[model samples]
Structures are given as C-alpha cells and as structure tokens.
Target: MMSAVVVAARAWIGTPYLHQASCKGAGADCLGLLRGVWREVVGAEPEAVPAYSPDWSEPARREDLAAAAGRWLSAESAMAPGVVLLFRMREAAVAKHMGILSVAGDAPKFVHAYSGHGVVESPLSLPWERRVVGLFRFPGH
Candidate 1:
C-alpha cells in the first residue's frame, strides 16, 4: 500500500504546476498531487474541491488545508510512510502546502509537487519540519 502511494506520486514527476489542477502527465499543484494519490490509494475524492486561487488561504490566515485534511483523513502522532502532511509557510499564513511522508526514520522525508520543481521527493529537513502544521493518515484499508 505504501509503495502504491509512492509510485503513484512519483508518476506526477515532471508535471508542470497548474493551480487547482490534478491530472497526471499534464499538470498539478501540491494539493492536486495529494488528491491524485488519494484517489489511487483510497478511492474517489472524499468531497469535491471548490475552485481556489493560488493564494487561497494566505489572507484569511486560517488552517483551511489542515482543517480539510482533518475532516477527511485520520490523524497520526508521527511521520509515517504514505501519510499526508500539511504545512504552514509562515506563523500567520494558512496551512496550504501538502505532501506525503515517503520515508519515516532517522532521516525523514516526503514527496510533493512544487511550482518550479514539479513532483519531487524531499527531505523533511529542519525548515520543512518547522513548517509542518498537521499530519494525516489515509483511512480504512
């Protein structure tokens, strides 16, 4: 199951960043990447995502992304393979970035699609760890 998620995420590698998009081999944003993985690993999306701009939660300063994850996914105490992660870029910014923990160990890491980098696996380094605002698990089997 974990491998499935990783592989599915990797498939999005090189996809161009397109806000609110979620199609593999075309374009996708961070949340779209996670949504793609969710469909692959869990099933259809739990709910329809509303049209959101690139700066969806910045002005509101609400943890909208984290709140939505809490609504649809299970919480986990620590980083685990294949778990979803929500990040708050700044103290006052909303949690917008999303990723999946791909390696959980002494050297923890995750995979996310970024604007310029496309989909890539990254280390959950100090800066990244500090940004993590919430963690969630895929429910059911």
Candidate 2:
C-alpha cells in the first residue's frame, strides 16, 4: 500500500514547479504534489486548501500546513515509505515544506516538487533530515 504512494509520486517526476498548482506533468509545488498523491491514493482531499506562500513569506510561527496535515493524516513517530515529511525551512519558521518518503532504506530519498527544480526525488541529506519537524502517514495506511 505504501509502495502505491511511491509509485504515484514517481510518476510526477519532471513536473515543472508551479505555485498553487496541482496538475501533474504540467506543474506542482510541494503541497500540490502531496495533494495530487492524496487524491490518487486516499480517494479525495478531506478539505480544500487555501492559498498560502512559502516559509519565507509566511509568519515564523504560523504552522498551517502542519496543522492541516495533522487533521487529514495520521501522525507517525518514525519515517516510513509513503509517510509525509514536514520541514521547517529554518529555525523559528513554520513547517511549510512537504514531501513523501519514497525510499527508506540505505539510500533514503523523498519525492517533492521543489521551486525551480520541479518534482524530483532527492537523497534525504543531513541538512534536509535536520529540518524535518513532523512525520505523518496517509490515513488508513
């Protein structure tokens, strides 16, 4: 079941980054990529997502993305395939970035739609591993 998410997420690789967009292959942001995967694996989005800016533009303590992910996904204590990773880009900033853990073994990796880089699966490097503030699993899995 978790692999299903990885499969779906991988299909979006090469998608150009587009803020507030969710159409795979066309464009998507980090949240958009997650939302698209959720729709494919979880049936439909639990709620509509309102427009929001990146961490740099948002207030330092405003954690809307984490709050929403908490509401729709089950919290997890450890990283696992298909689990969502929430990242706080910098100290004191909101956890505004998100990605699905695509690989969890020796060469851990995650699939995310990065600004300017689009949707790409990158190694779970130390810098990224450090900023992770929360881990969550899609409901029922």
Candidate 3:
C-alpha cells in the first residue's frame, strides 16, 4: 500500500505546475500533487479544497495547510517513505508547501510540484528538512 502511494506520486513526475489544478499528467502544484495521489491511493479527497493564493493566507498567519492535513490525514512522528510532508517556507510562517516522502533514512527524497520545477523528486536536503513543520500519512498507510 505504501509503495502504491509512492508509485502513484512518481507517475506525476514532470507534470507542469498549475495552481489549484489536480491532474495526473497535465499539471499540479504541491498540494495538487498530494491531492492527485490521494485520489489514486485513497479513493477520494476527504474534503473539497478552496482556491488559495500563493501566499497561502500567510498574511493572516493561518496554518490552513497544516490544519487540513490534521483533519484528513493520519499524523506521523518521523520521516518515512510514503508519508505526507508539510513544510513551512519560513520560520513563523504558515505551513503551505506539501510533498510526499519518496525515500527516507540517511538520504531522503520527496516528490512535489513547485512554481517553476513542476512535479519532481528532490533530495530531502537539510534546507528543505529544516522547513518541515508537519509529517503525516494517508490514513492507514
């Protein structure tokens, strides 16, 4: 089951980044990548996602992304392949970015869609890991 999630996420590699969109091969943002994976692995999303800006409500300091993950996904304690990874772009900022852990341990890597990068797997480098504010798993992962 966990491998299924990783496989599904990897299937989206190279998808262009398109805000608020969630298609497998066309385009998707960080959250969209996760949403697409959710549909493939978990049947359907637990709730509808409203249109959000690139700021992700940071002006209000609302942890909208983290809150939603808490509500729908199973929270996890440590990094592991197939876990949902939520990141806070900056200290004291809203946890806005999302990714799926594709590889864990000494050299971890995660799959995500960024503004310019599209869907790709990146090494979970220190710079990226330091920004992680939340870790979660699709229910029953």
Of the candidates shown, which would achieve the greatest TM-score relative to the real structure?
3
What is candidate 1's local distance difference test score? 0.84
Better-scoring candidate (lDDT), 1 or 2: 2
Tens-place lDDT digits, model 3, residues 38-136: 998888788889989989889898888988999999889988889889998888778899999999999999999999989999999999999998899
Q: Candidate 3: misplaced stretches above 4 Å?
A: none
Q: Pick the candidate with the highest lDDT.
A: 3
Report every candidate's CA lDDT: 0.84, 0.89, 0.91
TM-score of 2: 0.94
lDDT of 2 by residue, 1-141 (tens): 558889989999999999999999999999999999999988888899887765434655667888898899899998888889999888877788999999998889999999989999999999999999999998876
Alpha carbon lDDT at 49, candidate 3: 94
Tally clashing residue pairs in candidate 1.
0
Query: On residues 36-67, what C-alpha lDDT tens digit does candidate 1 reach at each position?
Result: 98998889998999998788867777667888
Report RMSD for candidate 3.
1.2
TM-score of each: 0.91, 0.94, 0.96
